[model samples]
Target: MGKLRVKVDLALCQGHAVCMQEAPEVFRVNETDGHYPKVEVILEFPPEDLREKVMDAVRYCPNRTISVEEIPD
Candidate 1:
């Protein structure tokens, strides 16, 4: 199995939770910490094609804070 990863630039996040909204299994916000705080998350790399989904999240992000990188299988 391979590992899929998502990177976020907190500086540009702008508290947007689109990634979390689109893929809850892969993204989250830690409300306990503060408004729109990223909590422990995972990138659903199988089934629905996570790379594309994460990319969409990155592209749709008004702040452009999300990115998806593929790992060797």
Candidate 2:
């Protein structure tokens, strides 16, 4: 699998958990101080097979805070 980088914008994320729903293996949400939970990446460099799932999270993020970039060799 090719290398990849993933990031989530905490300021923009609403903890909707759509990313987690799309790729639970790569994303999760953490409740913070009783406020809306925050999104987290469980796997920054997911396997090749899970690439699509990661992309799905990026696409499905309600706030468009999720981003995944390919790392060139």
Candidate 3:
């Protein structure tokens, strides 16, 4: 699997949990504060199926806080 860097814009994020609901493994919203402490989860690329799920998360983010950048080695 290829590597992808995901970054979240906290300033733009409105504490919405849509990203979290879409990709809990990659993005999570704090239940106490309803905010994202750190949304970006830059681990090794997940499996193909999960990649699709992550893509959905990025695409569906209400605040458009998530971004996926593919890195070429």
lDDT string, candidate 1, 1-73, tens digits: 3566677777666556777776676777666455455534554353446656666676777777776566766
C-alpha lDDT of residue 50 in model 2? 90
- lDDT of all predictions, in order shown? 0.64, 0.88, 0.68
Across residues 1-73, which tens digit of lDDT does each residue of candidate 3 receive? Answer: 4567677777777666777777777666654455455454544354456677688888887778777777675
- Please give the range of 10 consecutive residues that has the lowest summed lDDT in model 1: 39-48
Clashes per candidate, residues 3 or more apart or on different chains = 2, 0, 0
Question: Which candidate ranks first by TM-score, i.e. highest?
Answer: 2
What TM-score against the true fold does each predicted structure earn?
0.63, 0.91, 0.70
Ranking, lDDT, top scorer first: 2, 3, 1
lDDT of 2: 0.88
On lDDT, the candidate that comes out on top is 2
lDDT at position 38, candidate 3: 43
- RMSD (Å) of each candidate, 1 decimal: 3.4, 1.3, 3.1
Give the total clashing residue pairs for model 3: 0
**Tens digit of per-residue lDDT, candidate 2, span 1-73:** 4587888889998899999989999999998997889998889888788988888889889899998888876
